[model samples]
Target: MSGFSSWSRRRRRAVIGGGVAIAVITGIGTYVASNDDLRPLKVDFVLGGGDDPTEYGKQLKIQGQFGGLAVAPDNTTYLFVEANDETVMWRRKPSGAIKRIQVAGMNASRATQAAVAPDGSIYLAAEDLWRVSPAGEATRVIERRGCGKANPLVATSISDFCGATVTGVTVDKAGTVYVGDQLIQTPPYGSYVHRLDGKSIELVAGRPAKDGESVRPSNPAVRKGYDPPAGTKAKDVVVPDVTRSGALAATKDGVYWNTGPGIVRINRDGTLSPFVARRSPGKISDPSGPFDTVGRALDAPVRSGTGGEPGDGLAAIPSRDEIYYSDEGTSHRPVLEGDFRWQGVESDAQKKLLDESKTGSLVHRVTDGKLAPVIAGVQAIATSKDSLYVAVTTDIKYRNTPENSATAVLRVQLPEKN
Candidate 1:
């Protein structure tokens, strides 16, 4: 391999310590005590269903396979969107019951993410963008054709929702919508944090600051870190996947997101920085940026013995700055007889390996600069003031017959006394 490629590969492996194997640790007590409420909130999962069981049930349902998660500013409930093929929005009441809202041809194109403005206007992303109101009315905010993009997966087309799939969205107090585009397989292999001004989109960072002041790289903390591969400079590192867009939530100070590599927060003035910088580094499932160093935060693989897949899916409750994300294994092969799960391998290891390779999910939690595992075998996740929600998919086959697979939406809470 060339120097650059070798560097890139080494950097990727170095991000995770000790190769891909993970030693399991379970205890939310230490991590939860540092945050607000001083107690673990309640968690529950409500299942989604379709009129046709054979078509939607037993398999992944569009409504069931949730993509983006956002909490309403008022704190009454949470909102989420389906993946690319599904454009419907589902509202989860505090009771853990989900109601599907039909926007009626609301941006018929594919949707990768969604967010809500302070006023409760739902911003849904497809190849095109639409704004849905609490009253159920929908209107187009932007379209792909007019945005100067030829495809939905390019970097230059970030503004059009045509390139670098829309992975996460947020709205500021001023009503400016911040959209995170994870563009890989394209130039600038990093995420473009865009600001929606009226009907147009503009790059917020890697450019000028407010008041026409030219933004320069001056922060030693930001500049002194690891560098990308040769010729593949940091300026050109496009985020590898949606995992970089983990739960784009805005605070009075700035915006926060979870990438497969680590958690990052962009300041109100557009200074990009790390939120949680240390975790075992490796090629996490759908990781967003270049992996060059070890001890960086990484999404736990759905299973063990798996490496180099990208990670995606993140959600967080902003009021408390509590965040959650999942790292899915790129491989999907099931564990057969005599596999490690059958050996003396521990169940947690077997489960992580299977969840990454066959069926399962890995969940990570971060707050006040501390990180720890909260759950596994989750594919998608969201958060609210009162709870943490996760979607986990597992595979199943029985005696030469293909049994129906199961996808679960699990809710978890901290023990109140903690």
Candidate 2:
């Protein structure tokens, strides 16, 4: 089950062009408005769309599917692209010069995620954890070690180890590296978040389940389409599909990550708590102020039913204590197949759900315990001091076409705080 679970997760990541379709609302620039207070933001095309890699920086056209995005302190942008089965990191300086950096000794076909440290070091998370120095030197910081064959139902103890599957990576303002491990093959069969300082690795949040232990559901209700065998107790049934984690973002307080329904934080004090509550189905509204405590933030009825399942993308502005998250929405069937086209729908209800999922997929800004919609159809997002960068697919219906499947980055200016 563990091996099959790992393959299922990777297959989901391999699908391209799942972002919500971007619509141009105005002539000056592409402006998307969410609500009245959340003003319409103009999106400028940064770069993307080309047939060849050599033509990348020349005509502002880069070929390949977008993987991840990050911005350094000096406003330099790092865009990860999966081209020819290899992960390529493109660095865009303040002067707009684009340079491609590929880490040596890494597998070309792995789904690589990247995060930039304060000192400009790039951390890549694939099967293992690696650090690419500012000068383009790559070093394997953590090697992949499997837990071998251990039954998750009766394993007495699970070791704290970096396993074969790593879902996401991020660095905080203090230059600490945090990795999200799915721990699919490891005993206990759940997600774990690990923190790596200079010398040691610590399991900050989550752990392998002990013998005969059942992991609690993060959200209130069981997800749709999950059914257990007859007479199986809820506490005894383990579902590997919903027990995954991804997309880590760090702030001064701690690190925030996607745990299925919503985001949770591992605080500076070494405590785990909910940062954003699991969204309920209804109209969402903007709250006025930050919650007094983490518990209040978790329980407060700020709004719900806006963002999709947390973890599509997460970005943080440590200076402002603000975080941005993206949701690709939920679907009844697989959004993309081998050819990048939408899969066949089973029913009208499923088609309606798919159509509704497109609109529910959005990027939101979380500040002072309040969540507000920023834009629609964001695949990945990054932040600079003054702007927000988003990767999106221009046309959704025509994603099967190579030209229409190109991913583009857009820049949105941050509004002045009142």
Top candidate (TM-score): 2
Per residue, candidate 1 scores C-alpha lDDT tens digits across 207-254 of 112243222224322221112212222222233333333336666667
Error in Å for residue 260 of model 1: 5.1
Candidate 2 per-residue lDDT over residues 231-263, each given as its tens digit: 322232222432334668877677776655556
**Top of the candidates by lDDT:** 2
Candidate 1, residue 140: lDDT = 69
lDDT score, residue 192, model 1?
51
TM-score of each: 0.56, 0.66
lDDT of each: 0.42, 0.51
